[model samples]
Target: MCGVLPIRKFILLFTIAFMFHVSLAQEGEVASLSQNNLQTYIVYVHKPEGLHSMQSESLHRWYQSLLPVTTASTEHQQQRLLYSYRHVVTGFAARLTGEEVKAMEKKEEVLSMGLHPEKGFWKKSNFDKGVIIGVMDTGVLPDHPSFRDEGMSPPPDRWKGRCDFKQTANRTFVCNKKIIGARSFQVYDNLLHSFSAQPVDEIGHGTHTASTAAGNFVRGANLYNNANGTASGVAPHAHFAIYQVCSLDECSSTDVLAGFDAAVEDGVDVISISMTSLNVGQLFEDSIALAAFSAMQRGIFVVCSAGNSGPSSNSAYNAAPWILTVGASTIDRNIIATARLGNGDEFDGESIFPPNSTKRLNSKLFPLVQPGINGQMLSQNCNNGSLKDINVKGKAVFCERGMEVSRLDQGKVVKAAGGAAMLLVNQEQKGFTTYTDPHVLPASHLSSAAGLNIR
Candidate 1:
């Protein structure tokens, strides 16, 4: 699951939302955009079984033949064709105006196509041996201990994917047997100019997900001395591939489709996607749903995040029956952190930022202040620049959780304002669920009830 591109100008953030009727075996119609505005559109074509094994150059020419001839130069027309997909689906992604899309839809071979629009463990056994799991996220950290290939066999002979993390001036990445392939689809987006073209993970989400999927065993893994123990993915013996479809904060639908196209062609047994649109869309119109349908046709297991708006009614995403839609679930353990108020009221919470023995904050009770006592809207969340008026030096700042503000960022705001500690309380919707986040300052995430008492 990921963002969807609009029919016109490509925005930084694209999300899929719409309803349409179309199936791969039948002809489908599409709404047209203004010809003046040109953008990338996924074009699905009916590929013959013989074409499935065609050479790359032969396939490219077949895709190019579908486009209408124009007065533009050959090189200019070539640039318009972005990708020629053969496995995930018989299609191509190209820069086209509404007029061009209208023309392509008329082709008898074209199937339904639209704007480009997710895990888990098991018994440690041969259940995952010779299996290949494809991860479509930001990317992976090849050097992370979890991905090291010690004690692992080489990838199966059927594997066709290859790593694309070419050595650059300042960065280098290598793929081992455990992580057999790592390719980036973001280069086609051209929006990420600051980052390198390699498939290295800058955002930690991809690293975490990859490590949780089929990462190799790493002994004595822990965060800040918490949860100390060996860590390993459920499918420790499974070969995996990384498809970087997301950037720092955004994911384009076209890029994500390209990832699907590659993963399917690469012979992955399972494809894991942990991103989704804000709302649900039609099966054929949504990019992920469509690509997943093609992947399902190829016998690939598709697992997708049900979206983050969980614990809410109708919050499910990836509703297509062919895909396995998963959501968050509670674990058996917790990393407890205690917050003691001046009045001797103690609240037990959670935090992954373990206590540093050198800086014992429990020795004495520090002054605690709630910045929102005066009813300042932003102060309640400890947003940046919201605590400037509050004198919280040498004190612990109590903050309420708010939308669009990360818990660690709230701690940064409190710490920047000279506060000694942070007590992050959850919103009503969050209830008693507290995340064990690593905070910049000594912090504890409390529940809604705890927040009310603190208030």
Candidate 2:
């Protein structure tokens, strides 16, 4: 009976062992077999802490050796290791939310006021809804009160975006906090790099030019006080989108072109360019002009200041046919007065005045004088020269027209000599006004006779 029991137990153990071996063999065959003969799997490897640099290679070689000889040859080699922890895992299908869309749209309004207010023609149509005007200049002061409204509702969705001033690997597009639809396209060192603490107006020219186009009309009296300090722009209600195109030292044509392209792609409605270059052919072939033309074809208006070299035969980039050239005209078309002081009195000489039909001051007109003399006082003939010990404070200084120096340059001299204002008379010819406001402190031009009288 005992022998029979032992035999029964042996048969049972054999049967179980044989079934288990068969199952293992079937599993191994299935593992070796691949569907479509092209199956692949993605593997993410985590390295051991404090492992040597070569440990990964050594570990891979050891792992490869452990595979069955046949399976090893058939297995495809595909391995990826992540060395940096900065990147976040994300799928390509991710999209911006509704709130983000509104944020992006608001950037347009903010940019419009900063760059091109005249282009915001919608204001004329009573459309409170603003358009985007991109200013590819320096960064803007986002905290300026002109862009903020105390009681207005929040901006709509679609105007939100990111700002990447660092120009890191892929960071770009900064959204304005106060101005809805306002965004800045600063490309690190490439273009629009912010160096100082605030996007300040280092060169007063940019601030002046920008203020003339779309300065914020904060107070009700701003419109009436256009003749006063920091007057209102042509379009006060419009918004601004500032793009820092030029830096403190230099400006690059390539950066300007890139900024233009980005502005168009972002759907900016207008682009105001205050800068000018002498290279016409280069500007024409430039991708910036082409992009601007594309925007123009889409009904976008482009306005630019005529080079200060106007009132002469010399033409500048703004003079180009495709651009709207703006020439500087004295307010009310009045004759710009240039006065000179000597011996504590005012006089004018040889400076040619504007046309007789031109506007004049309502105050009493002093009698005209000759090239070297005034009515009562004998004038010192300093042909575009300076006077010594002259009480020029709160008074005008008269300088001759010729000296081969710019009127502004002469104005600086007068200003440095403690002169309050300057009057530059034409020396070479008549019927022309030199753009002198940009040069010296509060300056005006006078005819040769008016200049002599003031001198």
Candidate 3:
């Protein structure tokens, strides 16, 4: 994590949410849809001033009233309304037909509507005190040392969020003043469920982003004696309200909106999100954009990722003008390792795989083989089942990076195939850029040019 300057002014950052796989309804195109086609649509309504003063139940009722009534069973009607947006916007996400949507649009209170899609450094005294940054991603590990509340003040009295994490027998995830609030919005997804009933970060993404945003100072922070130093977030004193919206596979648009509703209602100072869908539609057609606009209106800042389909023309996502779109870039620091060939040629590379303190690779030379050279499909990617026929026993297997295969998976494949080590070559599109990854075996990620030379 790079050291970021302390946030002197109240600059809010926003994150784009969800990996939307469903096709989106284009603007003014809903009228052509079949009248009976029932799909989830995000409806935005004009919020009357002083609506916040109303009771929560009353607000929910107001949103419920906007939903078209049906003669079906009460349970069926209740299921139509997926989520209500009180904080992020005055709206609701519901299952509506084309005719029903057209009817809703005619209402005077209806402002706009859209389709639903499915998915930093320390500063002690300058530490952003009292600022609450709402993280919308995977759930967090509340017990991480980065979120310790030492020298941190309690959240301000206006904070209405609560910790929803429950203790389990194996581990106890506790929350303090630093990690003020934690909640999960995985109730909408019927296919994939949250790893736990609580808002525990099953994946490390939430913990990583949370720490990077406002983690506390921890000494000797390093991964296997590399990048060793004191680690702290950009704003050590800022409070975090984690809203877990993603499951293992994808983030549901309904669940994400619920999270946004809660985060905005929680009175967070900033909204930071790192997830993005493969496709981002027009401004009004995207739920994230609509919700972000509401957050901006409420004086909250939003920040988002520029997506991973980069190094390609027009590959950037989350390019909305209202939110800050951040892209990945190289920094000065790198984890140095080397890929030395049997031919006495050496290529300096990067890897996070820790070397044994007593062992060195220079003493021995293993046969270097490329799995796909013998004409096996996907062997270059080192995908599972692709190396079954390849005999890489006690040899250093060279693999290509990409093809929707992760670097970790590639190393795992090599390790499983009885390979001694792995040499990961970046695809041509990646050019000179290389990334360090924690592999299951000894591995080095070499740039595209070096990989070509080795080949």
State each model's CA lDDT, in order.
Answer: 0.77, 0.43, 0.76
Q: Sort by TM-score, best first: what order?
A: 1, 3, 2
Writing each residue's lDDT as its tens digit, candidate 2 over 1-455 gives 23211100000000000000011122223323444332222122333455335444565553343222333452332221112222241111111223432342353212211112233233334222354555555554444444443333333343232233333354333334323333333334443455533334355444455445555544443212222334344544444555555565444565566667666665556677766544445544444455567768877777665655545676544455565655554543322333434334543222222223213432334332232344312122222444444445555555566545655566666666566545666654663444424434545665555544443
| Residue-pair clashes per candidate | 6, 66, 15
TM-score of each: 0.66, 0.47, 0.64
lDDT of 1 by residue, 1-455 (tens): 87755622112211112111122321112213324466667787887667767888898888888887661557856878878886687788777776777777888888866553201124323537788989888888788888888888888888999888777787677888888999988774454365556888886878887777777778998889888898877677788799988888777777888899999999999898878754335666677888999999999989887665656787777788988876656767898889988788899998877667415887777888888766697998899799998899999888999886888899899989999888999999899989988888889999999989988
Measured by C-alpha RMSD in angstroms, how accurate is candidate 2? Answer: 35.3
**Candidates sorted by lDDT, descending order?**
1, 3, 2
Give the higher-TM-score candidate: 2 or 3. Answer: 3
Candidate 1: residue 159 lDDT (0-100):
91
lDDT of 3 by residue, 429-454 (tens): 88877887888888888999999999
Candidate 3 total steric clashes: 15
Residue 160 displacement in candidate 3 (angstroms): 2.6
Supply the TM-score for candidate 1: 0.66
